[model samples]
Target: MSTLPTSRPSTPFAVVDRDRLQANIDRVARLAADRGQALRPHAKTHKCPQIAALQLEAGASGLTVATLGEAEVFADAGCTDLLIAYPVWWDADRAGRVAQLAARVRLAVGVDSVEAVQHLASLLGTAPGRPLAAPISPPTLPELVVEVDCGHHRSGCAPQDAGAVARAGVEAGFVVRGVFAFPGHSYTPTGREEVAEQEARDLAVAADSLRGAGILEPWVSGGSTPTVEHEGHGFDEVRPGVYVMGDAQQWELGTCSPADIALTVHATVVSHAGGRLVLDAGSKALGADRAGWATGFGRLLDHPEARIELLSEHHAVAVMSEGTELPPLGTEVRVVPNHACNAVNLTDELWVEVDGRLVESWPVAARGLNA
Candidate 1:
């Protein structure tokens, strides 16, 4: 038998099962190691330094962040190697900040357009601090990785255009280290392995293109939780973030198991009527990210068959299929969000627990670094 802590009364809070979190981290790390590739997990999922440290301790090569602000926060947390894996539009103000960061640690940014390359070359070319672009003719600043679109069609040039972008970066005084892609199309249940195969094929082509332009290794980086579905070693690094905290989406997609879910939203049963219970956690607590396939706003972790039919800022209506009884009012239930990324950004802190024992609260240090 297990005993749970009933010391306080704080509902609508995010909870982290420390054991599950560690297991998730170790699973990915071991997978990456077995494949002989580096693991630079996208930190946008957790945005917690303590968790980042856990990843580092688990032998992560570095960290992948979406924003410079996130990079700064992680850098301050002693994460030296950072990759801003987004096609960041370069301007003087942001470049200066990036240069400062470069001076402090190993920094890399994603590039897509030649104009971005030109602007980076202009501002970072042989400038005092760390240059954003560096040429083979002359050593330069931060590394540049071309973002390739692998079936996502969201960003990056075609696989054939990888060389053009790498050439532009190299000519503009940027060290074209490699190419990266996001296989977002793998989010579906049945298409994950195929998408992963397509991603590998695309990266192989992109790497050849870069190598043709004198850019080697091409660090072909890509991986989402779904695409990590089956392992094939093509990309140098895989950036899977959501695995850190499995969500309802991952569970529904069959990408993760319930035991793999590390984070859950604790919501109180505020109202009960008509065989339904309304939870205090709503859009504000869990975030409103309903994919076309999502069953509802979120799913009850304790009651996997139950669905949150409706959600408002402060209410989550729970509806169980078939004949099922709703927990009485004042009962607390845990919800796994449809999307963990957005749900985590909405919370300020996460309650840490190990083996059903309460631990401490971990602040979401980089929660709102949207810029």
Candidate 2:
């Protein structure tokens, strides 16, 4: 039997600069504070408890997750307040787990259907059969946040349908606390301003609809790193996860310049063939989420002019520009991944660095907890 590598590998790997990460955290926190908006950064980007703790210590109101398992991971790590931002479907089994989770933390679940609301209410309204941990007061019951489709066209109800959903949640014994949206279309350069505007307009309309339904505590929330800068004043909270560790997508959209990129795959040049340099890192390590408008699989930091023409599971082929000299074989270089969230999940642990020296390692505790 072969043993796994327990220590940092001598070969190249993903490196995270603690200083850069902290700086990005502070900058974004300050920006949200300046706008008087609460910051509950999405933890799905890094999926590391250390990074989450840093964001909280730097003044984040709470953490936002996309899965019930993610919520459980953070809650087990002592995170008191958590928001499951996805419009999750619930049945008897899932609702039972959700009710159990609500008992441990200040929980908020997103709902886009009346059935989901009714299901959650039925679970929360009933008492647990056995105490999982130390006996305490019965759970306060989780809050519900109606998801409004603010141009993401993803998993959310229409802003016009907000009132009906809020009314349903209220009647189902769930407290309709606020509205949430992704505004994912804002990731593109040309769609940024318009999407941000639409997010604001949609959230405002949804909040009004909820208010008309007699729900006064309808907090408006929306965000994505590209559109977060343009978030309007009416939103009570903003959740931008990728700002902590920028990716090539953010770089191309001008959300973060090369200087702000904190996470990169350190790969070695294994071969040079016919004006092309092959790197060791590829789809498996760097991810294969290339935006339709993206230039390549990933960008080579050392040779900004070079294009990664192809990416296989274990190899990346970078075509050097005319008159550009390729680095020597066995040379290591940094690669900015296309999607930071996926890239982080691909690794078991991350290598922390400071001033070019290895400092620490952080386990990807919630990497595969996607349930």
Candidate achieving the largest lDDT: 1
lDDT for each residue of candidate 2 in 1-371, tens digit (9 for 90 to 100): 11234665754478888888999999999999999999999999998888899999999999999998888888887788899998887666666677788887888989987777765665555322422333324655678899999877888889988988888887766678889999998877687878888999999999998998889879888898998888857779999999999988988888998888899889999999766899999888998989998888988776778778899887999988888878999988888898999999998788887898767778878898888
**Cα RMSD, each candidate:** 4.1, 3.9
lDDT tens readout by residue for model 1, 1-371: 12244574488999999999999999999999988888999999999998999999999999999999999999999999999999988777777778788878899999877777767777766432545343323232678988888899898888988899889887766678798888898887677888989888988898999999998667778889888746457877888999999999999999898889999999999888666989999899899999898888899888988999999999999898787877888998899999999999998887888777677778788999987
| Residue pairs in collision within model 2 | none
Q: In model 2, how large is the Cα lDDT of residue 7?
A: 66
Off by over 4 Å in 1: 1-9, 125-140
Q: What's the residue-level lDDT of 119 in candidate 1?
A: 74
- Decoy 1 TM-score against native: 0.93
**Number of clashes found in candidate 1:** 5
On the 0 to 100 scale, the lDDT of residue 289 in model 1 is: 91
